[model samples]
Target chain A: MNRETAFNLVLAAVLLAAPVIAFAANEPFYVALATRIAILALAAAGLNLALGFGGLVSFGHAAFFGIGGYVAGIFASHAMYSEPLPFGLPATDQMPVIWLVAALLCALAALPIGAISLRTTGVYFIMITLAFAQMIYYFAISWPAYGGEDGLSIPVRNSFVGLNTANALHFFLICYAVLMAALALTWRIRDSRFGMALQAARQNEVRLAAVGIRPFRIRLTAFVLSAVLTGLAGALFADLNRFASPSMMSWHMSGELIVLVILGGTGRLFGPVAGAILYVLLEYALGGMTERWQLFLGLILLGVVLFARGGVVGLVAGKARYD
Target chain B: MTEPVIEIHNLAKSFGGLRATDDVSLTLRRGEIHALIGPNGAGKSTLIHQICGTLMPDSGSIRLLGQDITTLDAAARAQLGLGRTFQISSLAPDFSVLRNVMLAVQGRQRSSFRFFGNVMADRSLTDPAMKALSQVGLETRAAIPASELSHGERRQLEIAIALALGSKALLLDEPMAGMGKDGSRALTDLLDVLRRDTPILLVEHDMDAVFALADRISVLVYGRIVASGSVAEIRENPEVRAAYLGARP
Candidate 1:
């Protein structure tokens, strides 16, 4: 195999092994840390679909992420209180059911956001998406139904097909599996006909139209699909922390997701994973060293943008054979 | 005579105080290359844009295959068998030559919403794409990215993509703009054969290629069709000579 493929395999192996090793060593915190990497990578993978492949710089993905988190938080809360949810549907603590709700909610939310935001391009697209996210952020803070700015805490972790999800190892495995699945899905999309059309839309919407594809529809579909994946990650993240708050939907979260995608390699498959590992590790290492860890992170990001154009994956894997 | 595949009637477009396409009308007959030529800023591109639905006219009707398409968007127009190439060589630079054409092939087939199948492995898309590339003599460079191709090759790739879309009519804008003598001659020959199946509305600055390929020539001056006829009639027209052909031999 080529160096890039080898590096990718090694990274996946390391992620898988690190958690298992930590679980054996009785270090639940390290296992949770690994789970955080997987979940964050999945979120970044979602953003990469629109930003990297579709050339849509959506600066408001945190809205979908927050929506997913709220779905989980609200559902768990209703179930804990033994209260019926809206529309006569009982609150569900089943992981699969929660995932379905999160995905559907994200798709529903993304539709209107994408429809309005997609009408503009370049800086306008970025700002409009951010605006939409901010609107949601403020709404979440003002709406006291769920804890508002202080956030709602899940009394208990959600169940997953009889698995002991309270065990950090079990949760880590689940997140790892989902991350791998998301990675595979990203790869499949990169080679699919829709993927080709989406990339074409990014490069030249006019050319895409000349050949009979509606660039707007293709991008909107991609945007919704992207939101769904990120939303799934958010659901998992809420379960991991047992909390959902306005911070989950903040503009800062959106910016950080974009940063992760860029840090790895915008369009590369394993770029998000590599970026997540680097980002989380840096936060741990630098935050432990100094309170102003963001300054160092900013310097590193500047270096990546200026000197390492391809990102971590690009630096190690070399130029992509496909693009 | 065969019916015109594309018919534009009383088309007019204005930018503020400037009339870019002023009450212009034209016809692109079946199985013929109708060349639209004029001096720079004579609204040749503007007229083409109106016909292609890139720019809407202030007043007029455009009919493609006997269907009124004046109100349609560019994508809707293309779905009705209208294909176009830009003067600036627009393409998916990140996509390989084969994949670029594959997108066109897929456009003509079922919906592009197929999210599961690996397009690279799908013979239905690649086979037709490769066939179109072969027609444009770009099959050998199928694996190379569109941005990696030379300027002349990118032009050829444009034709290949149009062919893959199964276009009934082509709007070629400056297809020979940046080509060398030999490249232009090659493309001219390709167009000569291509017109047999698909009619072309060719907007070009290359007078030699135009004269060699256009079955009918329309000269536009200041957004007006100053002259329209066969080569001999256009060559003899005093207005055409005074406005455009004067610069050439």
Candidate 2:
């Protein structure tokens, strides 16, 4: 196989195997570390659908990610207290139910945000999306119903069907599976007709209109779908940390998600995975060396932007054939 | 006569102080190539924009298939069977030739919202796109990225995309702008055949291609139609000669 293919395969293998090896060595912290990478990568993958494929540079994806986290946090808290959710739905600390709720909430929130943000383009679009996210962020911080700025903590790990999700290895496998499934979905979208129209809209909206595709609708749909996926990641992340707070919706989280996508490769299927792995590794490696690790990270990001036009995937795999 | 495929009446547009499209009226009938020719900055492109719904006119109306489309946006007008090509080639440069045309085909299909199916393996979209590509003689190059195509090939790809849209009428803005002698001649021959199935409102500056293919010619000067008639009539019109053709020779 070619270098890119080989690199991609090895990367996937290492991500899956490293966690297993760490669990066997009785270092459960490394397993959690791997799970963190998968969750973050999943979030970035969602943003890539809109930013990379749809040419929509959203600066507010953290809104969806945070919403997802809150969904898990709120549900688990209500269950722990033996209280029913509003509208008479009983709270349950079940992973599938939490994921569904998170996905649904994110979809509902994304619809209006996408509809409004899509009416503008360029800087206006970026600012509008960021404005929406910031609105949510401030709301979360001020609202005291669920710990507000302090955040809510889950008493225990949520349960999955026929499995003890509390086990680090078990939870890592779940996150890894979800990440793989999301990667498969990304591959499907990149090669599909809808994907083609989305990519076309990014390249030239005028041309897309001339051929009779409404760019606004295509982008909005992509935006919502991206939010749904990111929201799912957020739910998983809340479970991983056993806590959720306003920090999840911060603009920095959104910026970091965008960075991960760019660091991997803008439009490649595995770009988010590669980017997340490297970012977490660097954060861990560099943070241990010095408290001013961000300076080094910034320098490295500048280097990638200047020298490697395609991010890590571009450096390892070469220019994307499809893009 | 049966209604023209597209009818524009007294269409006027202005930019600040200048009237880019001044009371322009034109029609494209079935089985005909109506060429709109003018010197540079005569507002040929502006008038096309108004017809295709990119730019709204200050006054007047555009009707397609006898439906008032004056207020429709570009995508709405396109959905009503209006197809267009830009003066500068406008294709998804990063896409393969086949994929570029496939997008147009998908646009015309019901519900391009299908997200799960494998579009690459779907025959319904690919088949029609390939057929359109073949019609424009670019079928063999379908695998190549559109940006990789030569200038002449890119022009052909634009037409192929237009055709894939199942456009009842086409707005071709300077299709021959950058073509060589042989390339222009080949396109002229293609238009001759394409006109039978879909009428074209061609805006071009290439005199040879215009004289060779126009079933009717309209000369625009400062956004006004100076003279319009059959080839022989246009050649004899003194105003048309003075405004445009006189400067050519």
Candidate 3:
């Protein structure tokens, strides 16, 4: 294997091992932290597909993330109270069913948002996306059905037929498996024909059109797919915390997702994982020391942007083959 | 007479107050290089844009192989075998020379939706891409990124892309802009070979290359075609000499 692939494999092993060791050492809290990294890494991996490979700067991914969380929250709430949904569908406490619904709903939400936002490029694209996410964020806060600004809580952990998800170690393993699947999916897409067209669109839209590939179509697909993955992560995130809140859909959450992707690496496959690990660790380490930890985080971000353009992955694996 | 591969009739475009293209009409026949020559701001690029579907003509009709394609987008027109190179050398800078050509080959095949199969290992894509690169004498530089190539090489790479697209009609806008003497000569020879199957609408300033290769020449000035004829006829036209070729010609 090449250096990058080797580094990625080592990263995957470490992520898996850290959680297992935590479980063995009776540090379920540490296991929860590892789970948070996996879920955030999965969410950032979704964004990386569009941001890094397709060059879409979507500042609205929190919409999808929140949508996923609400899907889990709304369903689990209905299951807990034994109430049919507003649409008259039976509520499901099943994680797989929740994930599927989350993916579908996120895709539905992303289609219109991406279609509108993609019409404008660069700063306009960023603003429109941020605007759409804020729209959803406000909608969730005002809609009191799922507790609104107060959020909804899961009294019991959602079921995963084969395992007791209430167990921290089991839940971490599930999140870890999902993260691996997402990373593999990202790798496959980077090598696929669709991926080629997406990257081509990123590099030169005119050249892509000259070759007969519609940049709009390619980007929309990536955006939608990205939403589905992030949406899935959102469901898992809500389950991990046993709560779904407007905070999940907040603009700050959106910024954090972007931050995670950048901290890891923009286009590198394992970039988000590294970024998530560093971000969570920093939040844990620095947040304990001072309430103003973000100040330090900002300074480190500046360092990465100015000196380490490739982010942590670039530092570890060297420059990407093509740069 | 060769059949016309592309027909642009009564094409006109105005950028606010400026009349960029005024009633420009041209035909690119099968098996010929139809060269478009003009001075600066003479609307040559604008005309190319309209034909390629990037710029919509205020009033015009474009046909590819007798089918009206006036309403299609640039990508649709390309899919219908309308290939073009930009004046500014547009390329996927991070993609390798082979991958750049492979994109065109894949575009022609229209299988960009395949998400699982590895395109690099797919011989169907690499074979045609490699063939086109070899045709343009760039097979040796296949692995190099487009960004790293010299100016002349980028032009060659563009031609390779057009070839890989299997274009029935080709639009080459200043294809030899940065080409050296030998590079231009090699390109002239390549274009001569390419025209045997795909007709070309060439917009160039290199008069020697134009004179050496054009089956027909159209000279534009102030957004109008002042003269259109054979090399000998255009060289002798008094209006063309006075307006463009200058007093010495």
Clashes of each: 0, 0, 0
Q: What are the per-residue Cα lDDT tens digits for candidate 2 across A1-323?
A: 87777887888899999999999999999999999999999999999999988989999999999999999999998998889997989999999899999999999999999999999999999999999999999999988998888988877888899888999999999898988998888878778778888988999999899988899999999999899999999999999999997889999999999999999989878888999998999999999999998788888889889999789999988887652
**Each model's C-alpha lDDT?**
0.92, 0.91, 0.93
TM-score of chain B of each: 0.97, 0.98, 0.97
Clashing pairs in 1: none
Q: What's model 1's TM-score? A: 0.98
List interface RMSDs for the candidates, in order. Answer: 1.5, 1.7, 1.6
Better of 2 and 3 by DockQ: 3
Query: Quick one: best lDDT, which candidate?
Result: 3
Q: Across residues B1-249, which tens digit of lDDT does each residue of candidate 2 receive?
A: 889999999999999999999999989999999999999999988898888888899999999999999999999888889988889999888888998998889988844687778777889989999999999999999998889999999999999999999999998999999899999999999999999999999999998999999999999999999988999999988888888877442
Residue-level lDDT of model 3, residues B1-249, one tens digit each, is: 755899889988898899899888889998989999988889898888888888888998999999999999999999999999999899999889999999999899999998898888999999999999999999999998899999999999999999899998999999888789999999999999999988999999999999999999999998899899999999999988988888655
Q: What are the candidates' individual DockQ scores? A: 0.73, 0.69, 0.74
Q: List the residue pairs that clash in candidate 3.
A: none
> If ranked by DockQ, best first, what sequence of candidates would result?
3, 1, 2
Best by the DockQ measure: 3
Off by over 4 Å in 3: none
